[model samples]
Target chain A: MTRFVVSVHIVPRQGLLDPQGKAVADSLRTLGFAGVRDVHVGRHVVLELDAADAASAERAVREMCSHLLANPVTEDFELAGVRPA
Target chain B: MKVGVVSFPGSNCDEDALLAIVERLHESAVLLWHKDHDLQGADVVILPGGFSYGDYLRSGAIARFSPIMQEVVAHARRGGPVIGFCNGFQIACEAGLLPGALLRNVSLQFRSMPVTLRVETSQTVFTNAATAGARLTMPIAHGDGRFTADADTLTRLESEGQVVFRYVNAAGEPTEAANPNGSMRNIAGVCNPGGTVVGMMPHPERALEPLLGSTDGLVLFESLLASVKA
Candidate 1:
């Protein structure tokens, strides 16, 4: 088995309302960062696992995302990185 | 009728629900622990409100996995009435017993105030006692109460008349100004397609007595009793 480090990024699904993201965007613009556009806020989750290979680790992380890490109704998730630790 | 109240580690409204059921509604009520799988033969199951699992990893995210939830899901699947209020609403959606997700309030603050809710339908066991278009005052207290769902789901809910309650003004108009948390379409409550599973962001159990400044919430309890009796 190989030790792997994984990074998961979750964001509100496109077209879903994200009040937190909107609030941050408004605050940024007020702070003189006018170039910022469509600012969206989300969650980043990191996990450490022992799996047979990178493919296996990625698959496990994906399952985790569907089960708990992200809510399909209002949020989407991406498995950002899976690497040997 | 026997009512079962599920209590999670951080649930604060279990006692209130019990008191309301036994004292006000005159029904036998029991507390089901999160780790317990048995429901004690409750005809109706209620998931009371509070910061379950400390609201970690999002509200209701963790509590959905409790051992008792399996029984609750089975109970609802068997067509038993199940009502989830406030944090319980979040748990129900997370558990896939209901549609939509509750996001942070548009104002991003923990809103704790009495708001007017218009009964959109009187067909379900939960709202059968309320007249169509009747407005009732209920207290809402939550930071994440803005309910959102995909357009398709929202359309389906609207078409099926599954929308049980909507935030409204005193005159029962669903205007934007009356929306407390910016929920889409001012939706305050919704039931599943079967109408056996219900979820709402407001605390009906909190407003059941006259001393609490409103007796409108008792209508929901009364409706439940009426349904169970019939």
Candidate 2:
């Protein structure tokens, strides 16, 4: 299987509010966790793909990010890694 | 008029903003790299839209620390005009040039669509050419376009007339959907207390050309032209 390292951050676009992130931080407090302030939630996606090269793989995933994987308005993604299996 | 467009790494709309200023508006402008600390005789500095520094840490968080931003802050403090659109707006906030932080939308979706903005104040150079009730149609593409501010800050912005634009309906009524992002008080744009620095989430450059659909954004440039020409 082809192994690739793809780091993606599900950040809020300009002017959007992140209630989920706020909720998570609040939950951590209820779990007896203190000193947790200004908590922001993000994502990391790692995939194994058999593609032609890194550029092509990134292009595919970027397209996926633009259309399927992520929302262009509220979130953004950067894709990398495509090696032969 | 000499204009400069700051291009931070990963800036996708620097070219679009430049074309609007130089080509459409028939003004001279340069593409300034983020590392450059010099303004190079540029009268107006534009921080264009698009994800900068790959939106690492925050949308405009990492970019705020860029060397070019230091110059921008200094220029604005010197009574020079500075405009930050979308991601650029985020950087301005991160740099403390403006107030509030951009957060995720309530919908939690990447929203790319047209929006309506009502000009709240026209005293600044950016809106000097327009009537107080001018309406603009522009595109907003971002996940963190939601504007958030504390109650005290919001009150101060309102009392001081720092807010310049608010999302409105086609008939000029304020609405929630018109905001696109769940911004605090439906703020789409704001200016510094000095009115030299303005930041907004809408892409006015995208609306400059009628061929692109709406030309409402051109008036913003026209307003700047009329002011800076003085």
Candidate 3:
């Protein structure tokens, strides 16, 4: 078994109303950044655990996202990366 | 009928819910701790509003895994009545007791105020006593209260009459100004397809007394009692 660090990114699903993200985008535009078309603020979670390999680690984290970390109705989750801890 | 109010860690409204049942409704009630494995034989369960698990990893997410929730879910699956208020609504959604999710308020503010709701349906166990189209005044205190679902689910919920309450104006019109949280279609409450599980962002327990600014919330408890009796 190897100790692996997994990073997961959970974001509000596309096309849904993200008020916090919109507020931040508006603030950025107010600060003179015109290229900001949209912003969807989300959560980044990092986890370290033992797994047989990177594939199993990623799979486990994906299950975690689906089951607990990310809300299927309002958010989408992606495994950002997996590295040896 | 005996009602059980689940008291999750960080739950602030459990007492209010209990009082609503015991003091106002004149019914027996019990507080079921989140870690408990039993419902204590409660006929109905209430997930009262509060920042469960400190709202970490989203409201109600962690609380969904509480040991008591297993029994609650089993009870709900057996067609037992369950109601979720405010943060409880978030928890119910996370628990999949009800469809859709409650998102951050569109205003990006924690709105603590009284809002008007129109009873969209009276068929659910929670709203059976309310007349369809009846206007109710209740308090909503939350930062994440927006009700959202995919377009297909939204269409289905409306077609199937699962939407139980709607934010409305003084005249009972569902207008933009009346929507407190920018919930889709001004939805303030909804029920499961079986009508056994209900969830709403407003705090009915807090509105049960005239001293609390309104007795409109009493009707909800009355409805539940009526359903149980029938």
Docking class of 2: incorrect
* CA error at residue B169 for candidate 3, angstroms: 0.7
Q: What overall lDDT goes with each candidate model? A: 0.93, 0.82, 0.94
Query: Ten residues in a row with the worst lDDT in model 1 chain A?
Result: A13-22
Per residue, candidate 3 scores C-alpha lDDT tens digits across B10-82 of 9999999999899977999999999999999899999999999999999999999999999999999999999
Model 2 lDDT at residue B201 = 93
Fraction of native Cα-Cα interface contacts (under 8 Å, chains A and B) also present in model 2: 0.17
Q: Tens digits of per-residue lDDT for model 1 on B1-230?
A: 99999999999999999999999987899999999999999999999999999999889999999999999999999999999999999999999999999999998999999999999999888999889899899899999999998888999999999999999988889999999999999999999987778899998998877888898889999999999999
User: Tens digits of per-residue lDDT for model 1 on A2-81?
Assistant: 99999999998897777788889999999999998887899999999999999999999999999998988888899889
Better of 2 and 3 by DockQ: 3
Which stretches in model 2 have alpha-carbon errors above 4 Å?
A1-17, A22-85
Error of 2 at A33 (Å): 20
Docking class of 3: high
Per DockQ, the best of the predicted structures is: 3
The best-first sequence of candidates by lDDT reads 3, 1, 2
Q: How does model 3 score on DockQ?
A: 0.96
DockQ of each candidate, alpha-carbon based: 0.85, 0.09, 0.96
